[model samples]
Structures are given as structure tokens and as C-alpha cells.
Target: MGARRMAKGIGEFLMELVGEAVAEVILGLLACALLLSLGLIAYLSWSFSPRLTVAGAGGLSLFLAYGAWGAFRNPSKDRRRRGVAAVATGGFTLAAATAVFLFFYGSDCGCL
Candidate 1:
């Protein structure tokens, strides 16, 4: 009976470790996706008009950077933080996309 209990305890510990590892990988992937999307936003903005308005571009970039940092610092922190960061990053990205679109379609911002 004692040996069985020990085995069960060890199994539970291993399962927890695996869960944490999976979470870490998922968070890392999220970070990479944010950065990649931000890059694409920047490229599209610049492509429209070498000097187009990048109003929220910098903020969006910073948002992604901060998110990555937060994830790296606290991998095991409540999953809520990760979700919040991702949402913030997405918001910034949307802002950047809007700015780029308005720059090309809206009234001339004299970027070009």
C-alpha cells in the first residue's frame, strides 16, 4: 500500500511538470506570433508610403515587447496575465492597422 501511494504521488508530480512545460511552450508561441504580426503591421505601413503616418506603430511595437518580457519573467503566474497581455498586444496591433489604413485611404497626412 505504501509503495502504491508513493507511485501515485510521483505520477501526479510528473503530470504537473508536463502541464507547466506545455504552458511555457504555448506562451512562447504567443509571444512569437505577436512579434511577427507587429512586424507585418510595420512593413505594411511603410510600404504604403515610405513616410506614412505610424501614429500607433510605436505603441504597438512596445506593447508586443512588454508582453514578451512579462511572459518571460513569470511563466507560472496565473494564466490571466498571459491572456491580458495578448489582448493588449492585439489592441495595439489593431490600432496600428487602422493608422496604416487611414494613412492610405483617409485624408492626406502629408506622409508621402
Candidate 2:
């Protein structure tokens, strides 16, 4: 075997995606909620508010990408399916929660 697995062809990747249930978005969202709730409790020890909790939780979630990166880099074929799930869930958490930081104080995304 090569030092790294061969890159997947677009057609094969598409077929794999088509066969998967992509709606595990709900699982990702639940993880975001868990992070937020945990942050809220931790923040309460110092000072707390809904806004800070959301932003802080979102900020903390970027750490999840380490797991995704590791999963992608691992050499085992047996764990590849679980790795796909990890990437999807981690990608959603990183994109939706870390970048979003939403719905506190009737605020917008404030991306600008």
C-alpha cells in the first residue's frame, strides 16, 4: 500500500454519498446544544448570560475538528464508515454552531 490511501474519485464519492443518510444533522445540533449547556454551567461560575454562552460554546466547538482530522488521517479501512460519520457530524458542528452563534438577544449572525 502507498503511504496514504488513494484519493476518492468524484463519481465513487457521489455514489457513496447518495447511499448515505445525510440527515444526521439533528445529531450535530444535539452536540451543539450539549456544548452550549455545558458552557452555560461553566460560565455561571464566573459571570453568565445567554449571549456569552452561545458565543463561547460555539468558540469551544472548533476543537471537534481535531477528531475529524484524525479520522481522515487514520490508515484503517475498517473504521472508514465511522470516520465519514465523524466528519459529517464534526463539519456540521463547526459550520453551524461555531460560525452561527445564534438567537440570543434577537441578534443577527454578525458575520460582517
Q: Which stretches of candidate 1 lie over 4 Å from their true place?
A: 55-112
Q: Write the per-residue lDDT of candidate 2 for residues 36-106, one digit (tens) a residue.
A: 66556787944757677677766656545555555456568565446655775566556555445443311
The deviation in Å at residue 41 for candidate 2 is: 18
lDDT of 1 by residue, 16-95 (tens): 99999997666555555555675687788788865453656566577767755654565564555547677765665666
TM-score of candidate 1 versus the correct structure, residues matched by position: 0.49
Candidate 2 ranges beyond 4 A from true positions: 1-59, 81-112
lDDT of 2 at 105: 16
Alpha carbon deviation, residue 89, candidate 2 (Å): 4.7
Q: How high a TM-score does candidate 2 get?
A: 0.24
Worst window of 10 by summed lDDT in candidate 2:
103-112
Q: How many residue-pair clashes does candidate 1 contain?
A: 0
lDDT of 1 at 2: 100
